[model samples]
Target chain A: MRSLPPLSIFVFALSLLIACSHEQDATAGSPGAVDVTAAWARPSLPPHENSAAFFVVHNRTDHAVQLLGASTSRAGVTELHHMEMDGDRMRMRRVPSFTIPAHGELVLEPGSNHLMFFELPAPWVDGEKVDLHLEFDSLPAVDVLAEVRPL
Target chain B: MKWACLGLLLVSLGCSDSDAGLLDFQGIGGDFTLTDEQGQKFSLAEHRGQVYLLFFGFTHCPDVCPTTLVELQEVFQRLGGAGQDLQILFVSVDPERDTPELLASYLQPFDLPVIGLTGTVSQVEKVAQAYGAFFEKVALDSAAVYTMDHSTRSYLIDGEGKVRYIFRYKDEPERIAQIVRKLLP
Candidate 1:
């Protein structure tokens, strides 16, 4: 077997290093790297056509991430919303995106940020699971199943 | 002089017995009439003898309002038999959307004894102002079109139809029930 030249060996080693670093970058920023936990949604009652879902998004990466929006088959439209207290008044504002800090978590809980589902085809019965497709700014879309709970 | 002192002591004792541990919100609430979920007139004076949890919110409110209702349901559960004497008056700030039937159906799922109330915009505004509650309609860019930004305080009215305690948002249900229990007969 013939051995390669010194320059060829150097090029091969450089390519291998680049490939390994690219793999690390892909793994670090993958959708699975971000953790979405404690996902749950309130049941929608009839004549009350809307409901909300809450969860905690843990961004394990060193870089911050943005949750742009979410979608579910159960509702006609979904939007990001935040409930804030403006001098004792509860103001529900439509938010464009929510940021999950690096190595930190964003809690979308009751009386805070939430995903509002509007125009529900039917009531979200208890014990059912809502499949949510969450779109992000830098990561691939993450799909989570939120359990419907009666408030 | 001794008789006067004794009479003064008796009056103070009577006052303490009736008003002790309750906050004085004397000028905050009064009698106001609005349309009930049954499409009939409902005046606060009619519920004078009953303890009431008065909350201003709309049915389209997905977060705070529903959570408040659920907390109230827990409050009622904690009250047990006394819960019967405790009534909840849910006044919708969004009068245009929360009609009588919608308000009725919106409350059916909670199972709480709530008298859902809605009326003309001016009527709701009058009652809200009377209780020192504030609300405004904001147009949204989303499919919801409009949402009401309203006060989240739940007024605890005693049997005399006077505001006794104002519960801040997310106040524990147990605490509310304990207070309501004290106001009950």
Candidate 2:
């Protein structure tokens, strides 16, 4: 068997270290492990006191992830809400948590599950961007920037 | 016999070139007096020659109410100049919270010709009952103490103030505009 050169051995060892670190990152539950996409919120009119934000949470991990809640400086209170149709009537209720299955996604959209913002400090205007801090059951909190769009 | 066959075919297909194809909701709607956003008494009988779209909702409803109004704005945009003949009557089911001023402010964002209507609890109840609309206040544990759950249908009244058709929740805006156009002069 032939032995490799000193330079070749050093480069091979560095590549191995980088590969191991990348694998470690995949299991560390970093913000990059989970993805939040299509984040947008509705523009709020005066005296309405409330608005809603929608997005899709994609979990790439091997285990199911639970989304506990979210917070934003734009509103005094933020809660998870689901809108359901009972016959011809529409009902909105608070939800405790949403679980995203392994490699699955949870979609929050209009007329469905969403993040309800109550007691808005100021009305959300079209083209305004709002920062949201999302908390999870196990992973580190993720920060998202949602755009305000007219309904 | 050929003419008789053509008549049967038309009847089976429900083919019509006029308002004969429109749904008849004759018994569902009637005249009701409510306070408009300007704090003036608004009687349905007063707007006899104009088309009206009536919707039951509240100002604090975060999702459906605004979504419906925005859809109405799109409908108006589709209608263009003809939309001026159409008036939207937004009846507030949450009489305790949705004052005339609040309804006015909430509806200001939508550029459509909208009349925000609110009245006393009993008055609102009477109007809702006349149209078979259902609405109730639901309590919550959050800072926003309660929310209103209401029917999500839009009643389309023709120029003569007769309920001609009912638009379900999230109906296509283009279709609504098309139906409303048929009602215009």
Candidate 3:
């Protein structure tokens, strides 16, 4: 029997490590599900301190995942908003739920859909972080850190 | 003698009249170089002869970016022959993810002269800052997970490669078309 070469052994070990790590990532049940990143609260004016948080979410798996609901201690309610333009008028509407398909991406971008946190119990200062409880279907519940920024 | 004097005065006045608009940077467009869809180097000065409508966005911005481009295409089509003298440029704010290949494929849906421009972070910063573009990278603490907050302004460039105006994201293409008519000679 011949002993394996060091180079070949190293390559084989590396590939196995990569595959194992990838598999471990799937244990979260999201397959390749990911929620929005670096989402934060935007400061607002008086009367209506309503502000939106923006982020990016991706689904790495081959199956579709739905974003069912989101909750935050900072506000009384959280909503998924989609900015729409009908004819020449621009408006924002609430969506029942946002969906992310396998190998697909969803962005909570400005001038588009966003996570709206309405009427914060208190105003947020610059550099403050808030905790958000985000719930996803078929994936683990995730806690998000929402940073505060000037309007 | 009177006719000769009048002719000379008119000639001098005509020579002195310059395009004051170009001399002033109205919309404040900065200069940069990035690869075009055809894999050729594209610089602002190279497109000097045409009016340009530039947007800083990523193809991944599913709704806003595509919707704006569609409206812009209609505006260009409305221009008819005037569109010939016009160029619509899409400069991706997410260069790390938006490659030349993706940009090319992404822009195929729009029927206009859509050029995608992207470069390194510093290079993109110079152009974005000059045009008042704002983008912030959101770090999620997860490996390889981040989001970008980019400026949502659509820049308008005149024939001289200078920024002429800026429109809000929701600005109607018809309003833009109205402006295009008076912009060209």
Candidate 4:
């Protein structure tokens, strides 16, 4: 087998190190026993209306975790909601709570389920991070940062 | 055995007739008259030679509506020069709050030539019925704070003013562009 050149080997090792660090950064900031990742919100044109945020909640512990609710200072009120198709119409319904099963993950995504922020006081600035407080039944609140981007 | 052969022959005939490349969407939509964002009288017949993508939504929809529009914007970009022949029409289901001026401003940020249309409740209902779209006003505890529940599907109309395909909100935007390019003469 032919050995890779010294310059090529150095570059390959550097890239591997960068990839590992990025993976660590993604899973680094977990509050308590829950791991939240890929949190993002769709940017709203006129801030006064409602908007949505999406993320994934992973339960690293053996016990089941229930997402009771969520809150944000930017909106007057925030609610847990999901979209359902009734006939041809798509309607948004408020969900009381979402459960993160033990050793499993709950994904909040677009066109399915999301965190609806109603009556936003101001428009979400592009590229800004909106701080979201996710409340659990027994665990302490987890602060997830959702980056606002144009949909 | 005779009846089975007859049934097979009938199925073949049905498949061949719908292979005309228009997808057998004959009765889904028809011509309608409405007012555009500029308060001008608009008719479906006027846009007969241009392909148009139609969606039913409201200005206040924070999640699905805007998300779909933004995706459409990417579709426009992917179409490149061919996009000039494509028209995006946003029909407001909540006519009470989606006025001409409001619709104009609400669609400005998408950076696409999105025409907003709203009419009287009955007028809008007629158009929605033509496309088999659903929209209903859901009143909350407070009368002033309410939202509309509407369908998130978009219709792809060919240049000859024929509804050829239906794109659900989850459909990939590139797939929509591909269908439109094939339909564009």
> Each candidate's DockQ score against the native complex?
0.71, 0.63, 0.03, 0.29
Best by DockQ: 1
lDDT per residue for candidate 4 within A1-151, as digits (tens), equals: 9999999999999999999988764544234588789999988775247778999998886778899999998888888887777756777777789999988999998877889887787888779999999998767778989999866
Name the runs in model 2 displaced over 4 angstroms.
A1-31, B1-18
Model 2's DockQ? 0.63
Per-candidate TM vs. native? 0.87, 0.86, 0.51, 0.80
lDDT of 2 by residue, B1-185 (tens): 99999998766544554675466653578999999998999999988888899999988887888889989999999999988889999999999988988888888878888999999999999999988899988998766688889999999888677887789896899999988888876
Question: Best TM-score goes to which candidate?
Answer: 1
How does chain B score by TM in each prediction?
Answer: 0.88, 0.88, 0.79, 0.87
Which has the higher lDDT value, candidate number 1 or candidate number 3? 1
lDDT of 3 by residue, A1-151 (tens): 9999999999999999998888777666533357567687655323233456767777776778778778788777777767654433334556777888788877776666777766578865568887877677777777878787643
Using TM-score as the measure, name the better of candidate 1 and candidate 2.
1
| Clash number for each model | 0, 0, 3, 0
Model 1 agreement with the true structure over B1-185: per-residue lDDT tens digits: 99999988665434344655566564688899999999999988876688888999999888888889889989988989889988899999999999999999889888799999999999999999999999999999988999999999999888788887889886899998887788887
Q: What does the lDDT come to for candidate 2?
A: 0.88
Chain A of model 3 scored by TM-score = 0.72
How many angstroms is residue B162 displaced in model 1 relative to the true structure, after the best TM-score fit?
1.7
C-alpha RMSD values across all candidates: 5.8, 6.6, 21.7, 13.3
